[model samples]
Target chain A: MAAGDSGEDKLIARLFGSVATHPGALGLKDDAALLAVPPGHELVLTKDALVAGVHFFPDDPPASIARKAMRVNLSDLAAKGADPLGVLLAFAIPPDMDAAALEAFAGGIGADATLYGAPLLGGDTVRTPGPFTVSITALGAVPTGQMVRRATARPGEAIVVSGTIGDSALGLALRLDPARSGFAGLDSASLDHLRDRYLHPRPRLALARPLRGRASAAMDVSDGLVGDLRKLLSASGVAGTIEASRVPFSAAARAAIAAEPALLETALTGGDDYEILAVMPDHEVSAFSTFATAAGIGVSVIGHTHEGEGLSVRDGDGAELTLARGSFSHF
Target chain B: MAAGDSGEDKLIARLFGSVATHPGALGLKDDAALLAVPPGHELVLTKDALVAGVHFFPDDPPASIARKAMRVNLSDLAAKGADPLGVLLAFAIPPDMDAAALEAFAGGIGADATLYGAPLLGGDTVRTPGPFTVSITALGAVPTGQMVRRATARPGEAIVVSGTIGDSALGLALRLDPARSGFAGLDSASLDHLRDRYLHPRPRLALARPLRGRASAAMDVSDGLVGDLRKLLSASGVAGTIEASRVPFSAAARAAIAAEPALLETALTGGDDYEILAVMPDHEVSAFSTFATAAGIGVSVIGHTHEGEGLSVRDGDGAELTLARGSFSHF
Candidate 1:
């Protein structure tokens, strides 16, 4: 019943009200907010920016834009096994961004932060003349020494992946041309599922804890398999091969891409996968799969590391299938 | 040079560098960077934005703009006894903004941050179609129970202000219309000093620790004396009055304003003072002043908080002089 209970002020209260912290916060009445770190958790900090047309579809719905903004940052934290603590968002909007759009974007941000048990810490807002931009600086806390690194892969380690790899890329292609998905029996529900997954990625923070001791040199597949895996391998000073027959693909994706041989390479090299990719020692592979199954997440053995420094994938006839090593670059 | 020396490669290095102890941060080679917090210090976070026309003059030099951006945020942190730790800059530029201007702006930011001992953390850059905008989110730390709050002022507390007041607004007015300057004696050096101070404020962060136990309540003066002090009184549920004879003014300010009576009132109430206003118990006033002087900062006793709920300033013989509280109002 206060006069300030509408618009940005209201949105701010709703976004940050759930943050439970030490008594030192003073309930957010000042220019800045305060937070205390408990003894057990180490803080994790990361920042990312999503520019209009640069990071996402410029015409994407506001909610989707908001979701992408938070999700990508969350994905980074997930790869580290850091649970979401809170986020600081600095948003610059063009005057063309209407009031309804702004409100919806804020709503989406609040929803995701609450869903992940993360609170909104603080942020800045400004108006620009050009396109919309959202920058989120995330903070999380994890127990010390449990984080996975991308530079620890060993030779002979089995390359493992979480969920499916090709779905997001396939979904993106379909979304770009919604009319004929080219899959004979594709249903609306399946299309929607893929679209949702592609639009909003689920960070594998859950697997971060379980993968700590077993998986060496882990990272999320943002860029497609072949591309991101190359970086992972280069970091670890190792490389490996995958079987073309084993590149996981949904039925719809397979049907759509079967006639276009280049599609396989595209799907393998495209970015935005947001799935976990790691190297597990052969002896620990079984236990790792079991642990993943217990957690109700998918795990697959896709390839293995070799002494050489590049990737190689063979078809069923044992002939090598050439591939590209770079995906979407940030610049 | 090392492999990371190239501009393009430098970005890759920056993204992958510095993974702290937090479990989710395995280094930045993946899609996001990770970090961990150190122990002991409580976090103080503040955010402020500057628009091209609204917050500043359009012709301000790029270095001054950057300096003002950090200064405004620092002023907020100083009010709470917070030591500035780092800053995140989110910039939105108009397409027409020159490349040289932008480079100068960035250089200024680098210089100020380095001088303050707070390095850049991370942020975003984007193109905008509207007014040029700069948003800064700052991080500072203070020990538990050491920060000040505006709402904690007692009824009998003495009110004090740091540094000279009314100079910036008067200085700005003179700069805006050189021909209209009331003082015929105004010279280049004096005008330059006043102009620089108006453009680039100095936040009193060093005084945070010194004033920790001294002041009961405090805040920065962004909106001139009466305006900002009105805010303090509203927060603390008290009323105050300043003696007109006791109001602080510089010799130059007096000379300039004497030509126009209305101009004097504007200076007294104009906003963006960037000074600290604090309330202390009457007994601690002398000690506070002494402490400030020892630190090489100026101080003045302006007013006192009484049990009432309004603000006023009285001339000699208790005659009230009605004036607008300093600064412009958005609405």
Candidate 2:
């Protein structure tokens, strides 16, 4: 009940007020914001939270942490085929955090808010006796009844994925232990590629229009492609078959797997890719791919849906591949 | 990017899914939710964060914590003269929080969501190595361009407040030290009254419509009456005078103040009283009061606005009173 004092108020206004460009934000001075949902559109809502030592390294750059938090929520909106509206941030600042770090964090959010057209609407900031944490709730808009759903995929649809997968997982591995075995073969560029993928996510917002027009079901791959696909299949009450060879990977990821064959499982099941996994009619694959190409996004058909209740992965030799773990879970 | 594991997913579904009754929630099976804004209405958005050990007692009942968290955000919406639409929760669970406590917390949210007509739409949950925290983003709807603002109070307007003040601050003091000298004369019923007021906040949602129609400016009294009134005055570029004797107080608060005259300052400056403070033309006060009475909420005219630059509080004999601190500030 002890609300924000002048110190907290001044901190928020100085740090975040500039990004709240939407008039509805009331210049971060009001108790709430007003958003006019575009006519004939429905609002899409999603929230994601990141904590130090869990989602990212405690010493990671403040800008990177802010960008990751905003991107993760934006990725959900993209998967739902919704255009960005705005975002609300709930920030918990550890006592030891410095003013410079907070300024950098706010700068990162402002940068992304501009890049993605998701203006900073309003937010709350509080002191915490724990690690620094950020929780973002992103608002989006989609034409009425046009939001792509995870439960609408039917049997015999082609399963499509946008952008390369597994890079982030390998990047995470390199981040965890850069000198680990098999990584000795990687060149500096390849190592940087893997690491950058882990540090920053590219939310496939450009694919929203195409997905809304043609996709039967869709969701972003945050918890690994295989596990997330399983979730999608479960939601749709169907089964899926993924061709391992068809799963697109960046050159860096391919090099990492080539050096360490055991790392293939990590690449396939590791999370944080933030790519869109979508389902559409088999006949519409070409059209969807064309749209993706026009938008400068890479699209790959990795598998297909069928009338079953689980997922199967097949290797190049037509042999089934088994993963040590389906996906990374923060249990 | 290390997404939620099966344990986290199952925990969220089992503990919080039942309350996501909005059709747009898709039974909490999707990554995001879809909400259709009623025609001719705009969305009102607000977010608030509560951290364990800072915002509330860590050992408080799980249900009480949940209700307080939810009500604080809803209170913001009510102040905007909007009706509840839905909410998204971002929860970071401490390592030691138990499942039974989580269930009770979710139960509390469900009860309030039902009572206030703000169903849970979607949310995210993650394990944290920090204190338990809940960040809620509440959505509401108001007729386009009709949201009451904190920056529109004009000169000569009547400053009215709903319900009593200082009860929560007194309650918090009693809670912190039940055997404090000044509270020794308080009966058990009075003590409970103060404690319950601190634990639960009535949002005054029923007055939204009346405020939208009549109030020139409005905001909730969360950070004490004097400080919050200063904010409202500052935002509107005006000043005001308050009659100290006219400020409403609950029977328990009155008793506490009578027992210890010094406690009056604590009541005036103590935060956590979530009543509505509204401004309106002097002639409209009677109609506004009638509307509030019909809605079963108390209304008190305690002050008047004028073309000035600061706030002044006068005693019964017109002597100005000075406060050591204007409000409760966390920092």
Candidate 3:
């Protein structure tokens, strides 16, 4: 049987059958899956595609690639203040992708889907002569009319971010040039931390409820904090000033920047930091921070929104910082 | 600005902003889209991916590629008896894909999304080093617990297919070798008919309401009719017998088969025929066919289900015919 015929069926059944735990998935046999929305809820839909060599190294660990594919879209749901309902995967496997690699990739998706409470609903798989690609459409649910929007931020709001920033970008830099001396002073543990941050993103889904209740606007920071904040502010028709010194950084990221002061620019302008960025009323910041802390996630006030347009970043000395590029663009 | 940053924003706004007509789409400026299901409806989800040089020729018209991508998923919704709500797209554009091609591609998507009432909700676009790839996830709605399934056909149900089969597979054959002598006797109109059938699929969405009310089992015939029927039967835990002579064929398909007798098998087992294959109780077949006719779509009763484990096809003389292969497989 050709792969798209019986072969495709066998591959889907063997690799992903376990993940189709939702009753509506029909054991992956139906043409489409069914999902019921709660009476008072609305569906949140987000899709993100990751291609080998562009989004990640073609030789990256299969599990890591799969997890990143799923998490990136999950991050959008989290930012939208929605709880994951399920995910549908569209995978195009290159000729060089082996069975073992595929198994590992499916395993990673299943693990995350289970852990995140988003069971596999349904999906399509096909062969590709190009790079292995995975595109995921994640469905989430929020109470009717309560999804946080990036356009709702107002002047005088505090710009807050979840978890440390720049770690993923720095980690990507380390991965791109393993022998670079920029982080030579860093210990193996620090190096590992950077690499792990690059490999796996922690989507701030735990803060969804708090954000829905408190955020004036929200978005996930995937395209670097500076650029993403700029977009948020642009969408909201406001300007923001980022206190560069106040931008949260992991110990490893801080050490790497300490060894190489210029790496801070890369950290600020690089992409793949899947943390939540939100604008909240100034009075609600403290309460939101307390809620985040109780949930074991860090929330930092990196900037504040002011009435205007365009973004500005100021150093501790009040000197303005200029970046050649704001975020990574695939095009 | 990197294409993923500002470049992507401008490209999306210029190309697809008009298709984001749903108020919940947030004018395509938000991280995710919101969709509220009707109070008594369940969401039906399906995803399909198309890769250049794999699913379609790299040089195929951009509009056709886009329509096929959207229609393939729409076919699934039709098969499930669900009305389309919206669709999410994940596009990976290769370097060689020029601006004009992209404009045409986006235009095609916009046109189909509007015509089908499945407006573009949201999507993610990125650059790829490989061939252009499109992944679409379509969401549809059906009354709760009323979705037609592939696992419900009984031994007494009639196997019916919409439109004609084998035209697309033959069209592909002609495309693969334009100078091939087997189809030499075909007129220009016939050849064009076959090619068009292969390039574009007419999803039987108009039959959704009737199928929901009448079909015991349903699925679209993307793969060859024989193979797809086998799948439907297998899922329903029944066997079936297809009367090869009774299978519907277009004038062009008939002429092509007459010119090359062997083309009959190609027609029987070729894929890309995006017609709905449904099984209905013997008593319901007439009313369903009437409904399909009233909707201006053709419905053919090609076979009947039986209490067995595998599919068998009978020739005009009631002799069993063996097929070398059943359907087109992407793997």
Which numbered prediction scores highest in TM-score against the true structure?
2
lDDT of 1 at B319: 90
Complex DockQ per candidate: 0.43, 0.91, 0.91
The DockQ score of candidate 3 comes to 0.91
Q: TM-scores of the models, in the given order?
A: 0.82, 0.98, 0.97
Q: In model 1, how large is the Cα lDDT of residue A258? A: 73
lDDT of model 1 at position B32: 42
Give the share of true interchain contacts found in each model.
0.53, 0.90, 0.93
Clashes of 2: 0
Deviation in Å, model 2, residue B3 alpha carbon: 9.2
Write model 2 residue lDDT over A131-232, tens digit each, in one string. Answer: 999999999999999999998999999999999999988898998888877588989999999988988998989989889969999999999899999888
Which regions of candidate 3 are displaced past 4 Å? Answer: A1-9, B1-9
Report the Cα lDDT for residue A231, model 3: 85
Give per-residue CA lDDT, model 3, range A152-244, as digits (tens).
898998999999988888888898787776689989999999888888998889999889979999999988898888888998899999888
Question: How far is A213's C-alpha from truth in model 2 (Å)?
Answer: 2.8
Residue range A1-331, candidate 1, lDDT tens digits: 0002237545544544444232333444555667775666665555666677656777888888988888777776777667777777667667687767877787777788777766666666655555677877676666766566677789998988887777777677667766653543567776776677777887776776777677777877876788778777887889888876777776656766674556677577766778888898988888877777887778888889989798887887879877654564432
Q: Docking quality tier of candidate 1? A: acceptable
